[model samples]
Target: MILAIDTATKWTGLALYDGRTLLAETGWHSTNTHTVELAPSVDELLRRTGIQATDLAAVAVAIGPGSYTGLRIGLGFAKGLALANQTRLIGVPTLDIVAASQTYSEGQLVAIAEAGRSRVCAGLYQWRGKKGWQSQEPPIIDSWQNLLDSLDGPVIFAGEINPAAAKLIRAAGKSFQIANAMNSARRAGYLAEIGWQRLRRGWVDDPATLAPIYLRNPAETSA
Candidate 1:
């Protein structure tokens, strides 16, 4: 089975997927409590699903463009599990998880993760038929206003969008669409699915060298 974890922001999530079934999934808004909440939650999920740590064939984690502490904790936990279990370690880009949750649109899809100081880490994506949404560029740090101003055509925005950001998108005019809450929330199930694909293709990362992708210095960003 593949175990997926995402602690990319204030939101954190976990899931178990065996390629054929999504056995379990859970997520919550953490008030900077990921350190205390993540491991126990993982244990509970595994226990409730009657799955043991040894049963994991691969451990997948969202590698940053997120908060320093959050990314470190998640990756450290995942890496420890992989090393201990001798399983594959898979790292999925954080924004790709957000983009995967949305339905296909003819226009562009912008996946975003909150970056403190009124900025967001954003990635542009396009649907790739059976392959799902593929990122068009590397994620960047930009304020909502500047991000909106940089877009020229109809676009669907997803991930970590607050009401204030939604209001700004609305004010940007009719060409922009904010994803619904359900689609906007990043879930580890999608992360698991993506990880499963990579695992099948032998694209796993070396746990010893794998590292988080931070668009800016983590010391200055909150994710």
Candidate 2:
């Protein structure tokens, strides 16, 4: 069984997955209460699932491109639980989880998340039946205009965007689909499922070395 947690943004979620099936799931808009709500949420999820920490095979967490504090809260809690239960830890990128929501597509997939100020964190991906969806390059920290300029063809856009972004996307005249509200936010169950598949394939990382995927340096001004 895998216990997954996502606190990369204001929307926080938790899930219990047993490789092939999701046993339980829960989430709420955190509203800056990550530190206070994380543990209790985990406890409630495990309780509701009738499972204990010791029964978990591993713990998966979304490790950023999001609020610094939110990332820390998730990673810290995940690491603590992994250490206490002697279970493995898997770090899935916040953007990758969002991208996975559209992995079924044959065209380009773009996953964007609101970056504070005026920029957005975006990544481009392509789907292949043999390898599934893979990122084309490192995620970019850019303004909505820059993102539009960089696009080459039809793309599926997923993330939190304002009216301006929506207008720009429409003006570009490129075919695109907006992810539904339920999927606009990261989903822990999806993260856990993907993490488990990767882990089985020997794609594992040291919990101690895991870190958030901040596309831009802290000193850089948001675009």
Candidate 3:
């Protein structure tokens, strides 16, 4: 079995996969309640699916470039579970999970997710068989305008795009395409799918040293 968790932002997600099939999945936006919500959600999911932690052959988690607190909570929990169960662990970039969730079948894509304080996390990706979107670059944090100016032409913009950023992107004319709302929702089934593939191919990460892809200085987040 494969268990995947994504707490890359306000959206909290989990999914269970049984090697050949997705058994169950869940996702919701929390009100700064991930610390309280995540574990219960996982427990309920496993109870509903009758999956035990010891049954997890591997676990996949979305490591950040996202909320400082959210990233820490998710990775810390995932590592504890993996270590406890002696299961394989893999850390997928949050944006990579964003890209994976989309149905963009072709062409270049710019997957963006929210970064706190009037900015966004951005990455470059392209469609590929099985993997859906393959990373062209790791995710980075920048203002939406800077990201728009840097693009050469039309590209699919997906993820939880800021409304102001969405408007600015649309104002760029026909060159920028926004993904449908459903496509923009980040779901962890895709994360499980990606992780299962990696598990089969022997691509896994060491939980002892894995860290969130924090693109901004921690000092910037001090309140």
lDDT of 2: 0.81
Candidate with best lDDT: 1
Model 1 segments beyond 4 Å from truth? Answer: none
Q: Candidate 1 on 72-149: residue-level lDDT in tens?
A: 999999999999988899999999999988888878999999877889989999989997889998889989999999
Residue 137 alpha-carbon offset, candidate 1, angstroms: 1.0
RMSD of candidate 3 to the truth, in angstroms, is: 1.8
- Whole-model lDDT values for every prediction: 0.92, 0.81, 0.85
* Clash count for each candidate, listed in order shown: 1, 0, 0
* Superposed model 2: Cα runs more than 4 Å off: 162-164, 219-223
On the 0 to 100 scale, the lDDT of residue 70 in model 1 is 89
Candidate 3, residues 1-223, lDDT tens digits: the string is 9999988888889999987888999999888888899999999999999889999999999987788888889999999999999999998888877787677544688888778787888999988876577888767888877888888665898898867878999998757888888888878998898899889999999998999888888667411
